[model samples]
Every structure is written in structure tokens, then in C-alpha cells.
Target chain A: MSLPLSELPTDTVAKVVTLEVGQDYRRRMAGLGLRPGVAIRVIRRSPLKGPLQVRVGHTDIILRRSDAVRIRVEPMPQTRGVPADAAHPEVVPAP
Target chain B: MKRIALLGMPNTGKSTFFNRLTGAGARVGNWPGLTVELLSARILLAGQMVEVVDLPGIYNLHGFSEDEQVVRRFLESQPLNLLVLVLNASQLDRQLALALQARHLGVPLLLLLNMEDEAQRLGIRIDSAALERALGVPVRLLSAKYGQHYREALAAIERSLKAHPALRRADRRALEEDQHIEQALDRLVQASVHAPVQLPPTLSERIDALLLHPWLGLPFLLLILFVLFQAVYALGSPLQDGMEVLLGEFRRSVLDPALAGLPSGLRSFLAEGLYDGVGTVLTFMPVIALFFVALAIIEDSGYLARIAFLVDAIMQRLGLDGRAFVMQLMGFGCNVPAVMGTRIMRSRGLRALTMLVIPFSLCSARLQVLLFITTAVFAPTTAPLVLLTFYVLSVLLAMFTAFIWRGRYVNREPLLMELPPYRLPTLRFLLHEGWRATLQFLRGAGGYIVLGVVVVWFLTHYPFDAPPASPATLAGRLANGLAPIFSPLGLDSLLAIALLFGLVAKEVVIGALAVIYSAGPDQLPGVLAQRLDAIQAMSFLLFILIYTPCVSTIAVIRKESGDWRLTLLAVAWPLTLAWLVSFAFYQTARALGY
Candidate 1:
């Protein structure tokens, strides 16, 4: 569903459908590899209602929750598979 | 020996790579030319020797900030044989911009994908070979955190050096925002990568709820700062006290006895001047080191960026971006680094603004004032309250100074900063940083402290060589001259003379006093304990805290601002404010019958 990023819940994991940042900020985000189709895991809900710590690839970024709402994503069942001692379930190591 | 420069965005494990490469430790250094300081290390990699200059991290090579200039200048000079472009794998796009800029420099570049493990953990996949093809450089994907990629990166560099022997420089125009190059990078990233990444649905809604709540965020920021200060003071005090006593005892037993056989003038000068002044100040090294260690740990763990986010708006009001707050916090430990940290402030005006307000951060030298007054003036119970007031006042002074600078030179741009994640700070890293700070303090005390003590002793002891009214007492005369200037502030004593001696090094004031006011152990109790009264003591504390930062800090300001006008402004403004504040407090205390 298309909702602002700020509406995300504490335990939710989501894929970034799109980033609705300004041109300057967009250029910066693009440079950081935060493309439209990147999956990000929310590590922390801001205590000050400021930003969410989303884990994308190997880095965790704090993006304003309002920014997150524009990106659309679908929910998947929380996998309980031995979690692979992995941080991101979707990532495959270099073969 | 081939020359190499390590370049990356802030928080990319470039430092870890340096440690892994050279086995040399990371410590702060004065970046050549600029007063701005950054981490640097000289390491011998492989059999053939090369110096790896760790360049300051920046988002873009095209910026006016001293940090950006530092990189640009190094690139322009063609000083290095090879440029090691370290990229945070987790944040590739932004890092690539810098790498692209490096490519434009046309220097032989080896791109190392640092933090690959963390990147994998975050569900991002990268094809190193693909990226290597795209950038026309060797790309080694390994975790600097675990030292996984060192061998591959090193081997690649060694191989490249053997084959090429000389590096090629890229044309500057090639890096100048060419759409063709940008499109090529995009195409390369898409073709070689096999990840259609998406944000998780649940986490999105959760963040939406918290960060968007206007009412909750600001208070949370305030609470975080409160807790941080409390932690700094609570955790640091006992360690600070222990060091103080140890240094005091060492002086009394070892240093003091060594000087006893000398004439009373020589004895007092050596015992009190060198040992007491610089010694007492250096003893607080433990606390200062603890503070810096805590700060570095927070920054490394990535939580410090959040602090920047939370306070960005307030900081912007001071003609500074929120980044300056981080620098100011650095100022709490030492203004030298804090002024240097101002390099992170993007705008020149904002950087200057940060530099100007930095001296207000109540550095370690001011800690002596805090300790002395809190103990001497108020009842032991009121010590905490006094300490709290001083901290609060320092912050208020910072805010007030920001307001003044904003009115004079306002930059109305809103702050946009990257907030890094909340990871637990690693113990190994924290201890390493802490040890460096502690050692610097010890070395500083050993070198500058001893020398400063000797100078003060010479100033106060030789020439006239008498007590109370000795002609050899330049320190006494200077104090007497400066004392009246402070009379309105209600602090005029030998302690005042010590404060003048303090201009050399704040700690020297203590040493000067130990010699200037020498009653035997029976007469003089807990150091300055017997000399100054509560009201005057508090005034003395207030004066030191606010007056001047120090000579090193001033020199750094002169270097960073480049204009002597700004440097003078940095010094004069703080001195005036300090005097006014101390006067007000002293009068208010006297009115209350303290």
C-alpha cells in the first residue's frame, strides 16, 4: 500500500518501492545506492519521532518516516527459518 | 616506495583498513596547512614501503569545506602513487560519487568494498567484478570489520603496482557532472547486480508513526542530551578524582623530595610550579580520555548521526548546520579537535559560526574551575547543583552566542543530514581510541607540562628570589596587574596571578599557585583548599570556564578561519562574554551572602 514512511510500525520490515526525496537529496540518495527497488529493514523507531533506522545492504540509514510513506511495499510472512545466522535473509554471499 | 591515499565517506571502515594494512594505530593529527585535524597513519604495506595517507572523508570532492579542500588539494598535487578508494558496501551510491570523482582525478585507483559483511546482513548484494568493470578499477569486496578483504585488496594493489609502475591522471572535465558518465554508471549497476531490493512493509509504517510525531521528537532529543551529560559526569568523576590524587601524591613524594635540597626559591618553583600546575591539569586526562572514547564509540556505532538529526533545527538557528553540534560536543573534551571537527560543516559561514561558538563548550581546562569552585564555594551537597548550573550555563552561552552570530551572518538553509543506524559501539575500538587519548595526555603533561612548570618557576622564583615581595616575580606582578581588571568580578588574589600564568597553559596556573602559596602540609591543606574563600573561588571558577579557551585552540582558530580578523573575533568575543558572565554571577552570589 502507498503510505508515508512515518506510518511504519516498530517491528515492520519493508522494501523501498520508491524514494520521494528532493532533487538534491535524491542525487545524494542515488549516490548512496538507495535506489527505488532496495529492501530496507527498520532497526529502530525513533524515540523523538524523527527517523527510522532502515538496514539496506550493509548500512543502516535513518530516513524520516514521512519519506517512507511514499514508497509502496507488500507484507510477507515473518520467516522463522533458522534465520541463517544472517542479517538480511534475501542477500546471497559472493559465489 | 609507492605513495597511497585512503579516501572514503565518513564512517566507512577506511580506518579499519588502515589498521589491517599497516598494523599501525589510528590517532588524530594536524592535517598539513589547515588547522583542521583528521586521522592519519603511516604504514609499511608488503615488502616495498609506501605511506598510506588517510584522507578526511567527504561526500563530494567538489566542495569548499576544509575537509573537501584537503582531498582536492592532495589530488591536485599528484603527490600519491595510488589512491585506495574505500567504499562502504552498505552505502554504495553516495560512495560511488566520490569514487567517480577520484576516477576523474585519473589516479590509479583500487576500490575496496569495506563493510561487505554488514552490507550482506542488510540484504544488499554487490558483484565486485561487475563494479570493477564499471569503474575500470580493481574492486575487492571484503569486510574491513573482520579484516576479510585485506589480502585480496592488498594483492590487487601489489599486482597493479608491478604491472603499471606509474599512475595515470584523469582529466578534471571528465568528472564535471557529465550525464554520459552518470548513465554509464547506472547501466553498469543494473546489468551486473542481481538484487531487486524493497523496503519491508511493517518497518515502514512503524517509522512513519514515530518520526512524524512533532510532539514527541524534540523532547526526546532533550532527554537524550540530558542522559548523555549525566553519563559523562557520573562515569567520569571517580576516575578523574583518582588520577588527581595519584598525581598530587607523586608530586609530593617523588618530585618534591628531588627539589627540597635546592634553595627555597628553586624548591618552591620546581615543586609547586611544574609539578602542581601542569600536573594537576594533566591528571584529569583520564576523564577527558573517557569523554573522547565515549564520543568516538558513539560515532563509530553510528548513533551520533541521530544526535545531529535531532538537534539539526536548533543548530541551524545559530547560522550553523546541525553538524556543528557534534563538533561542539567534541569541544567538551578539547576545543582543538572540536575546531577541527568544524570541517564537517558544509557551508563556510556555518563552519566559521561553529568555530566561533566552540570555545563556549567548557573544555577540559575549564574542568579545573568546575572542580575547584564546586568544592570550595557551596556546601558539599550543593556541589552537584553548582556543576549542573555551570554545564547548563555553558550550553546557554553557546545558544546565546549562536543567536548573536545568526543575527549577524544568517544562513537560512535547512539542514539535511544522513542518520546512521543504532549499532552497539565495539569495545575493541573504544579502548583503542581511549588509549590514544590517555597517552597523548601523559605525553603532553610530560613534555609541555614539565616545561611550563619550569617557566612559571623561573617567572615566580628567580630574579628577586624572595617570597611575598620578590623581584623575580613576573608572575606575581602580572597577576597583580591583571587582578584589578578582575576586581570588579570580585576575584583578586595570587590565584588571579596563577590565571595569568594560565595563558601559557591553564594547568600552569595550578603549578604557579603551588609555588606561590606554600604553607607546609600543616598550614596548606588540600592544595588550593586553604588559599581562596568560597565566593572568590566560585568567581575564579567562573572566570576560567568562560574567559579564554587556550593558546593551542587559538592557534587552531587562526589556522582554520584563515582570516586573522575571524581568529581575533573568536578570542575577543569569548573573553568579553566570560567577563560579563562571571561579573554577573559574582555580584549575584555576594548579594545572597555567600
Candidate 2:
């Protein structure tokens, strides 16, 4: 089942399924390691409609909630640390 | 001289390392890309002079972030003998990509894995030998904050300096062909490093629980800011007073007698206008240094990003993200750099709006002016409180301006900041940052303050025989000409002259009075104290707090925004707003019989 990343509970591990945004926006998101298939978890959310703090692999990223709504994530139950192929990989390479 | 540049992800302690290597000073902020400009220092490496430059940090190679663009510009323009890649060892898994990309730069590389102690505590370990073999470059561990393995790092630098010159861009085609880095990294990490599945919680986490707590964080942040201004006064005012005592003694005994040879009017202007004007500006050095301690702590500690996070909700409402608050904090030091800071935002509209709001922040120079006025006018117990009132007004004015202008510029661009874990700041770091800030104030605002004082003194005291500040004087005539505009702001002609000179720099607001009042350094405040009653003092303080920023800030606004019209709006709005706010307050206070 897919859901908006913002709707995920804090500490719930999930994998990004799709980024419902444009090419440039997706590229920017990828720079922060939030592309499709990264295992991500919500670290916390700011109060009163602020931003969401998330961890993709070892790198933590703080992004606004509205932006978070564009990302679709699938809950990966029973995993505290699902290894992302390259959630801000050991090396994202030249590709 | 050989050149080496340190490049890394933000908060990797790269700047701290640069400081130790070259003994140079620059503002280093925890928020990513806060370096904003290139900083370079000269040091002796391998018994020869070497130039060490610190590149603005970036998270990715291809990211279009301003920092990445800056790094690209540096690489395109400056040929380097070596690039020292600094990485937070604790986050090596995520940071190594930049390393792999930097390798493509064709410059010989040295991998400096900083924060080794934190990494070790987190049970993350790297086999430097194996990684060096795999990457074909040297690897070394560092704790930049603690000065750990510093000597060893230097030795490594010397050893790498002997490496054959890289073909550099000759490898561009090869870099383009480079692919499948994900699997390569997976294989590399498996062979060379023990990667953690999840980071173990540490002290930073516990602190974040309270500090980043939604309900508690905001209030605690406000309280901390309140205390910060108070602490600045508590620590700075005494130094200012002691310095003033010494300067006053010098002015009274030494300066007065030396100038005695001149005629009375010129002698007074020379003794007080020239000497005391500059002297009063200099005595603020200690206070300015003290003010930087707050900036130093916020920058050095990782809490700057946290404050941005804390205020993000409110900032979002104003059509800005948390990062604009970081620039505002930067503005507390000075607004020119803060205007340059708007580059951290991607949207052009947001940058314009942020630049508009930032000058309203009470920068150190302006704060120095306010400090003198408030201490002179308000009782000791309530002086800081009065300053706090002005500070509050400054913030309100910034928010109000942002609120009013957000319709045109507020973009809800997502804030994707890396909130680095907080590090404990050292006393050495504090003193180093304080001294740097003091020098910066002298450097950026120094010339303007001098020019403003001299010009104001000449304008007010010219026709050499005219009584000081008399209507026949140039400054008197100018003020009389503009009195219709400024008089409503509750400023008389002489005070209006000071305000006019203040456009060059706010420090001259105090410095200008030194000339116009023809009083010695310590006595300018006393003169103003007698002239300005409570109602008038509040009105004047409000005007100073909200008036146009210095020409330097205005010039930067023009350059950064690249819109002459917007720049004019920046100047116009503040002057008009300052008038409206001060006029309302003065009229209301007077109507109520104050």
C-alpha cells in the first residue's frame, strides 16, 4: 500500500515508491537522497504545519510538509533499518 | 606556492580544520552553505608556503544548490594542486559519494575523515589502509573540534604534496563514462568499512528531545534569545564603561591640553569632534566582541539549524522557510553578509523578500548606537529592558514587512537542510570567533564611520567661526532644509544631521553626535541624555531601530536583488516606516501626557 510520506508515523521505516513531481524537483530531491526506493523514516515533524525531519539511510533531511506530500512511500514493516540501495549512498557515482 | 582546498559536506568540521591549518578566522555556521563565500589562508606545509582555501560545503556533486555552483566556479577558475576532501566520519556512508565525484576532479586527493571520536563512539569503523588502496588516495582520521591527530594530518598533507600532478580536466571524458557507482560503493563499503544499519542514539538525540520538542522548543528558544540580549549587555556594558573611563581621562587631561593651542571653537571640535568621535566608536569594540559570542555559539554549535527548525512553522507563514531565520541571525552580526546570505534560498523572490527583512535586524553597529542611547537615556536597571524593547520592535518590523510583502514573494520552497548534531563549543573557539567579529566590524564599518564623523564635524562646525551646530553651519542648513521631513520623526535639526550621517553607517549615529554636540567621547551620551526626555528618546530609538541599513547593506541589496526598483523600495519603505512608527509612538505618548 502506498501513502504520502507526510502521513507516515514518526520512526516508521518506508521505501519511496514514486515522486509525484517534475524532473527538476525530482533531481533536487535525489540530491537529498529521497528518490524512489530509498528506505526513509520520519524522524519528527515540526508543530503547527511546519516541516518533516526524515532520515534516508544515514543522512538526515529536513523538508517542508507540503513537499513531503509529493513523495509516495510504502511502509516496510519490521525493519528499523532497511538498507537503501543508495539513500545518499556510499557513492552516488557520476550517473 | 602550492594550493590545497578543503571541500566537504556541511557541518563536517571542515572550517574548524581550515582554521587550525592556517590559523585564519572566518564565520562558520552549522546550517549548510552558510560559508557563503570562499575563505583562504596561507600556511607552511612541507617546509614551504602553501595556500589553503576552504570551499563552501555541498551535499552532492550535481546538485544545483548555490554552494555546489560556487564549488563548480572555484574548480573552473582555480587550478589546485590538491583537494582535501573532509567528511564527517560518522556519516561516511552518505558522504562518500562526493568523494568519488571529487576523485573525478583529477586533482590528487586526501580523504580527511573528521569526527573520528564520534564515529568510534557510534561503532562506525573504517579500515583506512583498505580504503586508501581501493580509492588510490591517502585516508586519515581527524577530530577537528578536539585537535586530535592534527600533527599526523599535517604529515599526511606533506606526504601527499609530493604526488605527481593530476591531469585534472583531462579526465573529464573518463568522469562522464563513470557509472554504476552504487554497486561499486556497496562493494567498496563491504570490503573496507563496517557500516552501521542504524545509528545509535547519543547525547545529541537526548538534547534534541527537549530542544526540538514542538511545544517546549519555541518558548525555550524565545527565552534563550531574550537572555542572549541581556547577557550581551551584562557582559559588554562593563567593558564599555571601563574603556570610556580611560578614554575620558585621556580626553580631559591629554587631548584638551594638546588642543589648547588652537582657537576655542576649532580646539573643542578637534578635541571632541575628531578625537572623541573616533574614541566613542572605538570603545564599542569590546561590546561588539561580546555580541559575537552569541553568534559564535550559534554558528559553532549545531543549534543554529535547530533554531531554524524551531521557527520554521512561523517562517512558513511569512512565505519563508527556516533558513531565512538563519540569515536574520547572521544579520545580528551585520546585514551585508546577511544579504549575501540570501543566496542560500533558491527562489529569487524569496531572496528579495529576505533581503528586505534582514536589514531591520539590529546589527552590531546599529546595536552599538542603540546601546549608547539606551544606557544614556534609561536607568541602569532598565537600560537593557529598553534595548530589548527596541529589539522586539525590530523583529516585529521584519515580520510585519515580510507579512505585507509575502504576497509578492513568499514561496513555499521546501527547506532541505541537514541538521547536524550539536557539538560542544570551546573557549578557544569563542575567543577566536569574537576577535574575528570585532575585526570584521572595524573592517566593514570602520571607513564609513570615520568618513561620516569627519564630514559631519566639518559640516556642522565649518565657517570656522560659526558656533558649533549654529544655523549658519552647513549641517545646520541641510538639517533645516530637511527639517520638515525629519521633524515629524521627533528629531531636531542637529539630531537630524546625525541621522543623515548615519545613513553611511549606524555607528556614526553616535559618532556624528560626537561632532555636532562638540562634547568629548564620554560626554556625547550625557549631552543627549539631557536633550532627550523619555518620550523623545523612545521615538528616536524607534527611528534608529527601523531606519535604512548602511550604504554597504543597501549596495549589497542592489547587487544581490539586481533590481534597482526593489532596492529603492528597500530604502524607501524603511525610512517611511521608521517615520510612521516613530511618529505614531511620539504623538500617542505625548497625547497621553508623557
- The model with the greatest DockQ is 2
Question: Worst lDDT window (10 residues) for model 2 chain B?
Answer: B27-36
Find the 10 residues in a row with the least total lDDT in model 1 chain B: B196-205
DockQ scores of all models, one per candidate: 0.16, 0.42
Off by over 4 Å in 2: A21-32, A79-95, B25-36, B165-180, B262-277, B319-393, B404-414, B486-545, B549-571, B581-594
Model 2's DockQ? Answer: 0.42
Per-candidate Cα RMSD to the true structure, in Å, reads 7.2, 5.7
- Could you give candidate 2's per-residue lDDT for residues B112-160 as a string of tens digits? 9999998898788889898899889899998987999988998888888
Candidate 1 lDDT over B222-315, as tens digits, reads 5655566557666776777677788878877888778777887666765666666566456556665666666676577655676656654455
lDDT, candidates in the order shown: 0.63, 0.75
